[model samples]
Target: MNKYSYKDLPSRRERLFIALRLPAHIQHSLRLSAELVQGKLDFRKWTDHRDYHITLQFLGDTLVSDIGQLRKTLRSAGAGFQPFELRVSGWGTFGLEEAPKVLWRGIEGELGQLNLLQKRIVEATSSLGYKAELRPYSPHITIAKKFLGQVPGNEDKGIFGVLPEQDLSDNSWLIQDFVLYVTQPGQTPMYEVVDAFSFS
Candidate 1:
């Protein structure tokens, strides 16, 4: 999706979501990884390092008045959980093979805990009128979008041909908190954290 100015956001309703903010070290590592293949690839937009996160739930175009209640609900929901380890995994794409719409880095480690936290957040927010996504939970940090580069082998070989073989086991970090963020377009870091919910 193209950048939308603050005025251009849907009906001026804040685009909000719940997510786990990656640590600086993890962000730096992912940034370096993206830099390694950026020149070789042809993607229109590479995600800003500050924007790197694992989305728990997307509450799109939300009412400004609802934010306080959302924060309260999130804090209560998050209090039951504890910190869990997670790491940046492999690379992949979303959309079609030849011309994918999104280029992303996958996630690994403590996936069951992550899913449980996500499920709790969804349930907590349901009474506030936010519906859970129909799609199954698949945690990933998006790196780029609008693929225009060519594959090495056959087009059917997909995005893996250009993927770097990097050992990211050391990229693991303890996710201690989740954040509520608002999307602000026409900015270097489009997403801004409004509040954070720390795990007990």
Candidate 2:
């Protein structure tokens, strides 16, 4: 007789997602972009650069019991997407400039492949009981959220407006793998990669 049962396995509910992790250099570049306006903004929670990533699929409040199944599904879903080059192109927000909910950096290059991979992930998990967000998938690295108020108009224009010509997006990173992450809400550096599935 076994001393441990499946019921006795350690488990916890998690807010989770699968994402493409950025390299150190690209990560710093994004932080620099946000830093350009850090002093000007007030009452906003900026994301830590270390947590920057491009979310492919968000699995909200996942049950610990379902992880094994999800892992297998993710591996199957991720297999067809060969490695691709991804570049950060520009900035965008979830709402109007004057009243934004989330500020993010936009993605370009090989996005069609990115979308196809995400489509497979969504389709794979739908039958397993994962519900994809209804909104169309827009890939970006969220730089900040929970905006309490807006920056002064001139400064806002300086930052959020059509930004002045800059070399922010010239760097490109190869995305060879995607990973599953567990997010710790109300914690510093919320997303932690728990497992990675590589593309062939």
Candidate 3:
């Protein structure tokens, strides 16, 4: 008999769904742009540039046993899409201007294709028993989080400064594939390519 039983073994890892890699030039531009926003507002904890990505879907956590079928389904879903161009620009917040919680950069152009792809992925994954996100998808790169009780436009003294209205030229990126990522609670997440299916 083995010394270790199932109860004594390490738990399975968490799983996530992620988008394909951004072009090098686009990644550079986004990093530089984020630097420009530093110290300008009460930005939430700045995300590391290495961690920057556009999420196609969030699988939350899943058992390792479920990963193989999830990958096959996602590949089939992604195979229907062709590569498209995406533009990133501007600054914005989620929720009311008086009580914003998420600070994000806007994504424009190729919006329709992105939506279609997202819908397909959701449909494909949902068939595999994953909980589907109920919120209407708004694609944006989250940059920061807002403090509690802080309202935008309140001009409260000595708390944090307002983010200046920025004039951003549209930065474009090409999408070629989608990736599957795994997120671990209480640890830096790990990302591995489950499958890379290209669009036209």
Query: Candidate 1 or 3, higher lDDT?
Result: 1
Off by over 4 Å in 3: 1-11, 148-170, 184-195
Model 2 poorest 10 in a row by lDDT:
1-10
Clashing pairs in 2: none
Among all windows of 10 consecutive residues in model 3, the one with the lowest summed lDDT is 1-10
lDDT of each: 0.85, 0.78, 0.66
Model 2 agreement with the true structure over 1-200: per-residue lDDT tens digits? 02234365537566788888999998898888778756655436888999999998888887676877888888887786788888988777787666678878889899998898888888988989888899999999888885566456654453455343455655798888899988877777777777899886
Mind sharing the TM-score for model 1?
0.88
- Summed over model 2, clashes come to 0
Please report how far candidate 3 places residue 93 from its true position, in Å.
0.5
Candidate 1 regions with alpha-carbon error over 4 angstroms: 1-12, 151-158, 167-169
Candidates in order, TM-scores: namely: 0.88, 0.87, 0.77
Question: Judged by lDDT relative to the true structure, which candidate is superior, 1 or 2?
Answer: 1
Residue 171's C-alpha lDDT in candidate 3?
Answer: 73
